[model samples]
Target: MSASFIEAMTAAAAQRPNALLTVASDVRPCTTRLAEVVAAGQRMGTRMIAAGILPGDIIGCMLANWREWLVVAVAAAHAGAVMLPIVTIYGAKELGFILRQSGAKWLFTPDSFRNIDYSAVVAGCGELSGLERHIVTGPAFEALESEGAISQPVDVNPEDLALLVFTSGTTADPKGVMHSAQGLLAELETMRLMRGGSDDDAVISPWPPGHVAGALSMYRYLCQGSPLVLMDQWDAALAARLVEQYRVTSSSGTPFHLSGMLAAAEANGHDLSSLRQYLVGAAPVPASLIEACQRRGLAVYHCYGSSEHPTVTSGVVDDPLDKQLHTEGRAIIGSEMRFVDDDGNDVPAGEEGEICTRGPELFMGYLDPVLNEAAFLPGGWYRSGDIGRLDAEGFLLITDRKKDIIIRGGENISSKEVEAVLLGLDAVADAAVVATPDERMGEIVRACIVLSSGASLSLDDIRDHFSAAGIAKQKTPERLSIIDELPRNASGKVLKHALRNCS
Candidate 1:
């Protein structure tokens, strides 16, 4: 048998059957012990095979960060099925696109969450050509468990595809990034070395399960037999309470989450001293945020990565505050990173250029062949499309992004996607979306528009249009600016840098 995550998790459970696998919250709190988690996965894996989900078939999961999500993910691995995690916040448009693109054989979702009827969303998605079964959590899943389980196990290999992560790019549609079991395991090992926490530790993860960061957190903790406390919805006060109650030793999030937790802890007088490492990334880290977290006895470190390759670089927990605040730290083990010019030649250490990386932790490739060809160089290094430089000591400093995308609260929002939506409105002649500085979210979407003659559109009007178009709420522009004409260069391209400066 190959080095499957399911096999490793089963071994861990055998050694520490009483360890807590997850502390999940829904209407009430629930805990899943390691042994129970393993058994649940086994049962679910049998159900998956009985439902005709074969090895290497795609299984989609569109649920929150609950215990069922973890169980289903591991079950997919045990059944030798490819796991595809869909963001819960995705609307019908995004969800339908993913379901159709991935050709998922089965989908797992909740009946309802946060007052949104997910079943209705699925029903409204028109046609899911390849979806053979839809399983709801709660009572529906229990009914499946009531059926007899299979006695045999599925065979899997380390090089077999295991995960498909859809990440928003410069286009309106998301790109499906693939990963093998071996690659993901290599990444987990690197993360373990970079951010140390043992089985005795507990992790408080607020990131959505759809993102690579959240999935990595779940798998990494399971591999180490650590306990995970998940938050279905992000509330700083609730997170602070959970940290204190569970004595969470490690956590990860963007600057916004870290800042909110600090504010909540200060306001409510919650003790957060149990936190040893808080890996902060997904957006530019502010010096003030790191300083505040460190003062509150939280070890905040800047980390860098993407959907294609998670955890490329990160600061050590014991590193100086200056290094943690200024740079993204050295590359983690098993990762080879470099900065190159347009010709793919290596740039000087201190010069800014495109960041490229390749290693065991790198993802397999994009789902689209054309995208894969464009994303890699001749030497198999994945082009990051980010502008950065390495210091003399190999610490990376990200200067800018080659793609015009705004990251708000760790979610990648394509400026062009929003711009396309705005241009579809009759009241808009031309539109360009840019990132606006914000103290909390790192950056928010701002639209600079040239309205049609005698047409007046407010920010509310634009937002309503986006909502009507079924765009995710996070992609909507938070601010709008009306201008006679966009500043442009000789090539007729709007100067987005100038628009950013207007903020």
Candidate 2:
């Protein structure tokens, strides 16, 4: 287990470098070849430190989705620095915490994406006093040239930090999830085993390359000697065109993004028949949505993953849409899953408990020692903090997040239960339930929602829908807020804190 992911990537790069790396809808080569790009990373890594950037430094990336991000990531790892991904989702406040906590010495960001001043954010980071160098990934940063022939990375080790990934936590602050070169690569092995990629493969995605999925594709797609097509932003119409035009075999995104693609398919009537897989995850995919994809001739594959443990569940072609949409499939080979109650005892089949796992896919640990110990419990099992159950078919069904459960009069009411019922109504496009302060019940269920097009829905309508679904009248939403969109993290999990603030 070398500490350099770029070293492993070098194998693929040497085999092929001019293969299309990224297809940006503009028909430009996203990557010429894997080897050359990685070699460039090695050279860039050497130059950055030569130009005074420190090794093992945390380099922040606050750029939009693009191929350059992938290049920087490889370069960072080759340079022996940890790539601290600062996605576009971070505000200046969230930006400061990640930069300061990761102890970033160099920062790379766009001058402005649309209207937001990312450089200004980097300048603002200067206020926190950790960032020493600022390099923009987009137009603002000066063009960078390779310093020299890619020097082999220095004595790399298995447990060294390769990336500092920030994942949302129950606590107000997001923690930096650390992944070693071996740990992250180990996680990708699960995807490799499941995908069994080939040289003829191609990937279509709008998920930003800054996160793990984006990182996963950097290797997974390259290993197959395939081309990757990327959309800089979530433009469904553009993405549909890429898939149709490129004869793309597969696409990936959160359920929200997939829903956007679905809408684009209806509006533009693009010939997505060329598409084979529309992989969806990060949020629950409604069975109805899965059925709709089937009607549209797109194979909707259910994939559930988090930044902490990417690509956990995947629906197969053989699985019925109901099971696909309902159960995250059994753990892939090399992964083990178990359900444990409050006492850490294994729960009986069909009983609800937190899903715990031990596999090559889990993150190395949180960057902070205290947090790592809590996240990875005794016996090396990582507690998912997600409530789930295993069915007779051995498929895992996630019930709700441990935090998303509403404690109403000390009775644990699953918000997912409320959402499931609400989504059953054709008018309800999506729903999220949270516990709000209440005088009588201590906390009552409140739903923030978005309705489907051409559907007129009211609070009572939603309540009755839940009632028909056999949901307890008490667990039904007492208050409702209709909105255009829910706040979601990079992984597509709804950001309830933002929702809670909408009072």
CA lDDT of each prediction against the hidden true structure:
0.84, 0.69
lDDT of 1 at 283: 88
Which consecutive 10 residues in model 1 have the weakest lDDT in total? 21-30
Highest TM-score: give the candidate number: 1
Note the residue pairs that clash in candidate 1: none
* lDDT tens digits by residue: candidate 1, 1-503: 44787777778788878777545465535676877766777788888887788999999999888777777877898889999999988888888989899999989998888776888888878899899988988887766554456446687888878999898877778899999988988888777766665667888888898999888877865655777788888899989888998898989898889889888988999989898888888888888878877777777888889999887888988887778889998888878888898888898778999999988889999887679877998889999999999887788889989988999999998887889899999999999999998888988999999999999999899888987877888998889899998999999999999999884
lDDT of 2 at 368: 74
Which runs of model 2 end up more than 4 angstroms from their true locations?
A: 23-31, 52-55, 138-143, 146-148, 221-225, 405-503
lDDT by residue (tens digit), candidate 2, 1-503? 44356666666677767667654633223545666566666677766667666567888876655656666776676677888876664555567777788888877776666556766655554476777777775443324534455566655565787777775445445578777777677766655556544656677866665566666676564433467777666677888777777777777776656777667877998777767676666555567778787887777776655667775667666677667767887776667777888778888878999888876667777777787766665888888889998888878888877766565533346666567667788888888888787643556789888889987887788767754543445667888888998889999999887887786
TM-score, predicted candidate 2 vs. hidden true structure: 0.77
RMSD of each: 1.6, 10.8
